[model samples]
Target: MKLKLRVIFFLIFCLPGLAILGYSAKLAAAAHGLTSTGLTANGTIVDHERQTRRRVGQWYCPIVEFFHQGASYRFTDNDDCKQSRHDAPTGSRVEVVFDPAQPSRARVDSFRGLYGTSLLSAAIGLPWLLLGIALVVRVR
Candidate 1:
């Protein structure tokens, strides 16, 4: 196949899959960071299988509500807290960082947590993407 065709095919198939993975990761990470308190009322626990360990893993995620720039926003861990550590007890108050311009943008701890989640999704998606590319190359 021509390079243009390969690129087009890759974008048509791989991009959607990767985009879904990436956006979901971003949302999960955003929600995970929003929770300022430990797992409890607004928080949730997700049981998901780990890609690396191939084992069922549990993650404690929190729901945080905060006010920034004269507006209030809320979010939850959803699925991004897979490997995050629980540092405080339930109801323990914690500082949450959020974008003042965008109150919905928040994090329970470090920004790295979200980045890690996104990276994890990319890592998981890369092999299939590469496999498709390989098949295209081989057929070509």
Candidate 2:
């Protein structure tokens, strides 16, 4: 019983914690310039939407050249606009941040932060964690 409980506990906590840790590591990597190109993109709002607070999708933004390491970094807005009704002009500027290691893996600057995405993951993950704990306790 003790071993079972221990395994259950580890599975419940470690898995979620690892997920959060991995996400944090990814963000830290971006912040520390572990990627290839640190480029900023000038985006034109090809489209827009404003329905509920839910995210729809992302489109292309724009690109700008900036100097990072010893070379000039070229950033591009490769995000597909969230599905919405708010219309953005074709030439609207959309801020884009890129992964230095993988320049191709780019996204809008506004969407790069870790807080909101972390929260969303936690909101969905915590419940399952709690349920696992509850089950373990009950079974014992």
Candidate 3:
């Protein structure tokens, strides 16, 4: 009975926590790589895409545009799209950091835009991981 409970609990909590932690680590690493090895350019907020969810309500995601190697590239900001529509009005300037080899894949050069997903995921995952570890240790 004790071993069965431990297995069940580990399967339910620990595995998912580990998965989330790994995914967040990957995201953080990508951001770090881009910042370290990418090219910097001035970008403009050309548009906003309206995104809605029941839990998150509605928010506008900034669509950014920049020129690289004489060609223009546009990419949606991948940051957590929880900001108000007014947060980034069109025509506003933003610093863009992109892989020079793949300019289309770019990110807004801001702390939140670059690292928000990783931070949020880590914050959510760490507790579940700790709880799962506690459960396993206590069960044993």
Predicted model with the maximum lDDT: 3
Once fitted onto the true fold, the runs of candidate 3 whose alpha carbons sit more than 4 angstroms away are: 80-83
How does model 3 score by TM-score? Answer: 0.95
TM-score of every model? Answer: 0.47, 0.47, 0.95
lDDT of each: 0.54, 0.51, 0.90
Clash list (residue pairs), candidate 3: none
Cα-lDDT of candidate 1: 0.54
Candidate 1 vs candidate 3, lDDT winner:
3
Least lDDT summed over 10 consecutive residues: which range in candidate 2? Answer: 77-86
Per-residue CA lDDT of candidate 2, range 41-121, in tens? 554444333333336444433343433345554444333333432443544565655665665555555644313454555
- Looking at model 1, residue 50 earns an lDDT score of 27
Instruction: Tell me the tens digit of each residue's lDDT in model 3 across 1-140.
Output: 88998998899889999999999999999999999999999999999888876787888889999999899999998583646867788899999999998999899999999999999999998888889989988996
Looking at model 2, residue 107 earns an lDDT score of 57
lDDT per residue, candidate 1, 1-140, as tens digits? 47777787677657766775777577665556554423222222222222343375655455656655555566664434445445433454545555555556555554554466666666767665676666567656
- Candidate 2 global lDDT: 0.51
Please state the error at residue 94 of candidate 2 in Å: 1.3
